[model samples]
Every structure is written in C-alpha cells, then in structure tokens.
Target: MTYTGDVQVGGPADVRELPALTICKLAVGPYDNNAYLLSCSETEESLLIDAAADSDRLLALMAERPAGAIVTTHQHGDHWQALEQVVKVTGAQVLAHPLDAPALPVPVDRTVEHGDTITFGAITLEVIHLRGHTPGSIALLYDGGPAGSHLFTGDSLFPGGVGNTWKDPERFTQLYTDVVERVFDRLPDETWVYPGHGKDTTLGVERPALPQWKTRGW
Candidate 1:
C-alpha cells in the first residue's frame, strides 16, 4: 500500500520508505499520540520516537531490529505513558531536551539541544528545538536530499496550525517564531511533516496558512 501517513490508535502503522531509513508511524495511548519507529535500511538498527503507549504493540514492531534509543519530544505526560516499560524491555537509551528531561518517566540518557545530531546505524537525525509548546519541545529533521526532508514535529506543529498555547500571546509568538525561523524559513516546502498527533502534512501545503495561523493567535 502507498504511504498515506494516516494512522489511528490500535490500527496498523503507516510506513514511509526513504533512501536510508524506513519510518513506521503508529498511534498509541488514550490521547492518540503518534509513535514513530525509525529503522535504518542499511544496518536494520532502529530508533523509536515517543513510546506513547501500548508497550506490547510497540515492542512487537521492534522485533525485527535493535531499538537504539527512544526520544521523548517534550515533557507532556501523554507523550510518555509507555516509556518506562518500553525502556525496560528494549534497553533503548532515553533522549530528550535538557529542559524537559526531568519531567519524563525515565531519566534521559542524553539531553539533546538544537543543532545536535542523533545517529543510529547509518541514519542521522538533526534536532530542532521548538520552544513554547513546552520549554523543550523539539522536532527531528531527516534530510533525504532529492527525496525531500522529513520533520517529526511533536506538538510544536500540526497540519492546520501550531500547537495550542492556551491563548497565551507570548507562548504563541514564541512557538510561531521558532517554527517560522528554525523550520519553515530553513527547510524547503517539500518537507514532510509528521506531527505528534493526527495526520501528516507538508511545508508546501501549510506555507500559505502561516499568516492565518499567526493572525488567529493560536
């Protein structure tokens, strides 16, 4: 089946294949958080993004490869409900931004900041810190060159608008600025966005709406 980036809790994962990595996106937990299991095509080593929930299912998906690390995108409780169990089973190193590390269920093995690179097998993902959603909310960027780039945006961004700032103007501005400068301004429009919840979208599809999102002050 073609990759649609559509997934639901208890439903099958949506897989996207690139030159160096294979991304499997699954939704888990009561909050319907998306967990991405990324496997390197060359070494078969994997890295999981957000062990949100359903330890059994997440483990089953990692059966074929060695899970190297689990990255918690932020400090949100909903995003790490299954984290402890998953870490116990896989022994995957826990990675998160230093600002949010203390809040995660498991202690972070390494605290990452913007411009940092995480490597497992031959795949490397650059970290992009997107503040405001949480002080340390982050997005991982994988540049596939001609195939375009893939951004794993956890709560900092979504299809139609940026993450909810609870109507706080300062918070909204902070998130919007980082998203526009660190993300939209830096990456190409062809970048595929894999958000922490719901379906995916591309920068090209969302660029025109940036102004609208800012105007609404969300």
Candidate 2:
C-alpha cells in the first residue's frame, strides 16, 4: 500500500463517537521507521508509539499536544533511540512489556501484559502480545473507535511482511506463529491495522496471506 506522505501534523481523525485520535507519522532514520503520536482530542492527551530518531522533530510534535505517555512495541534501537528525550520533555511515564523492559534506556514506569487495558477518559486500549519481532513486542487495540478496532501494531507485523529476525532463527519462527495465531486470529475481520512502518491495512485483508507467508518459509 502507498502512504500519501505523512498524515498532516495535527490532522485529527475520529474513530467511533469518541474524540478523534490524531496520528502523526514521523519517518525517521535510514530505515524509515514510523514513530506514531496518538493524540486524544477529548482530553488532549498524547501517547507516543516508538520514538525512533530526529529528536527535534519528535519533541516538537509532542510539545504541540498534551503529551501523556510513551509506549514502546519492542526494544529495537531503530524504534526507540529518542525515547529518553521524549520522556524527559513530556515527563510522560514509559510503558512496555516486561521482557523488553531492560532494553529501555530508563526504567519502565508501567509493565503491560497481554490483557492489560489503558484508558484516556472514555477511550480504552486493549493490549495484545504479538511477540514476533521481539519477546515483548505488542499491539494496542482501540475498540471503541468509529473504525471498529484500531490496532497500533509495532514492528511485530507490517504491510507486506513481518519484522526482520535474522539473528535468531528459532525465536523468529515462534514470533511469526504467535502473530499469525494470537494477533491476526483474535481480531475481527474489520480491524484496522496501523503498523510501525508503511501504509495501513485491515485484518481481513492480511488474514488470507498468513498461510502463504507460512508456506514461503521466511
């Protein structure tokens, strides 16, 4: 899928009847990792997903909203290099899975599990452990959205592929299976998947490719 540049900074898109969650996609580093800023219109609270790089621009976007917290999908440096700066500037608590907690630059304020829930006023986010790219990789599901369910899928799954795991063959396969069964299988067909990089797609659209992915033997 093709992304039409970055979603305009401050452009708010409402899901469900809840306040719009404005997402700003920051394309950073040589890998072009996507760091997302989830801003809640009702409370003006903002939560960042992956900090990546380009500290100045990332902080600038955070400063524009009521920065709330920083939630990482995993511990990969490409997705978390600017984390410390983001935390310091916003004084936002850092949340991550316990397994990836140590890889963080600072102590994690909150350790989230598979069934954990995060709420901002009326909106609630359900945590799903996708665990393929890394042991602690997770996906955040916003169920009350106008878009049905909105998934903030970190590096665990992407548009055309899953995250790279050339270092550990066994763990990589395990992660892939967890994502296919745990993440994709659990969601409804209409769920909107907002990945860490590339354009957005639905669970219904990507579900059919699972068998093909397994067959190819990545």
Candidate 3:
C-alpha cells in the first residue's frame, strides 16, 4: 500500500502494492475548518472527513473521486454544517462516534469508537477517541502504505493550539491528556498530524510544544 498525502506509511513491503490514499484538504466555514477527502487508488473508495461548510466545493471534490463514506470528527455544527449536502451527493455511509451521532444530519451507519477500525479496500483506518473538543470527538489513524502513519485529528489537536474547550472544561482536560498520551505518545515520532484547522505538523514537532500548551492550560 502506497500512502499518499501528508501521512507516512509503515508495514511490510507487500503492503506497498496496496492502493494509495489521497487526501484533499478544503477550508470551510468562517473558522476555516478543514474538511478532507480521502480517496483510494486501487478500489476508488473515498471518505470525507468533517463536512463543515461550503457544500458546493465539497461536492465538486467528491465528483473528482470515488466517495464511499462521510466521517465526522465531532458533533460541532461548524464541523458538520454541510453534512447533508455531501451525503446527498456521495450517497456514502456516514460514520461518527456514538456520542456525536445525534448531532449528525443523517443517521450514522457506523458508530466508531476507540480501537474500532474501518476498511476501505486495502486502506484501514483506526479510530482514536480524543474527547474534550467534543464529547464524541475522534481522530483517524491510517496505518498502512508508503505514506507511513497519518493522523486526521479534527478539532482535537492543531499545529499551534489544541481544540477549544467551549462546552466542558473537565472533558477538555481529559482530552488534552488523552491526546498527549494516546496519540502523541503512542504514534511514531515521525507521524504526521493533519488537524481540522491550520497547517499540518508531525508528532515529533508537536511533542515539544506540549509544555507551552500546558502553561496556557489549553
């Protein structure tokens, strides 16, 4: 499996034969949230991450790829405002954590949780629950291909800052620890992190910034 886009690929040499996953990041909404499209080369399977806003552009991106599912990182309206439009055009199954399912525009076909994995052809995505940004927030880990390991962090983690803890402070604290431990600590040092907003950064690069983040209580 050859992983394309921002993440690194790890695994056996045979896996290189697997189709590549292409990621297209679209900035939507006033907050400039990132909505992504993950497409597989071999099977032409695609997954949309965070519908956010701007349905027309999202649809146009889907038209260029084989869209199979829509996955929301959290339940915040700004992260899923255009969900209905994207779902209508792609006819893809919508997947989200059970906690955020109720906020989704349509019923979720797959309720993902920690340790749960979704496979589209040769590409397998491991779900990492990163609550705090939202009670049901999740980050996706693509583990196979030449691209190594790539993380779709949604609102949980960002380049210079972490997700806003607007609703629940306790949850945010828990999430901050979870992200630092589960995600930052567990993944390889070279792992690439594609956040819901702002520029992408590697786990290695973000690790050292934790102290600064802690100081700000973010």
- After superposition on all C-alphas, the RMSD of every candidate to the true structure, in Å, is 0.7, 3.7, 6.1
Clashing pairs for model 2 are 15-146, 16-145, 16-146, 132-175
Models sorted by TM-score, best on top: 1, 3, 2
Q: Report residue 95 deviation for candidate 2 (angstroms).
A: 0.6
Candidates in order have lDDT scores of 0.93, 0.75, 0.79
Model 2 ranges with Cα > 4 A deviation: 1-20, 167-169
Regarding lDDT, does 1 or 3 come out ahead? 1
What lDDT score goes with residue 101 in model 1? 96
| lDDT (Cα) of model 3 | 0.79
Q: 31-56 in candidate 2: lDDT tens per residue?
A: 66777777777777778888877677
Best by lDDT: 1
For residues 154-177, write the lDDT of model 3, one tens digit per residue. Answer: 988887767888646686678779
The parts of candidate 3 lying over 4 Å away from their true place are 1-19, 167-169
lDDT of 1 by residue, 1-218 (tens): 78999998999999988888999999986899999999999999999999888999999989987588999999999899989999998899999999999999887999999999999998899999999999999999998888789999999999999998999999999999999999999998889999999999999999999999999998
TM-score of each: 0.98, 0.86, 0.87
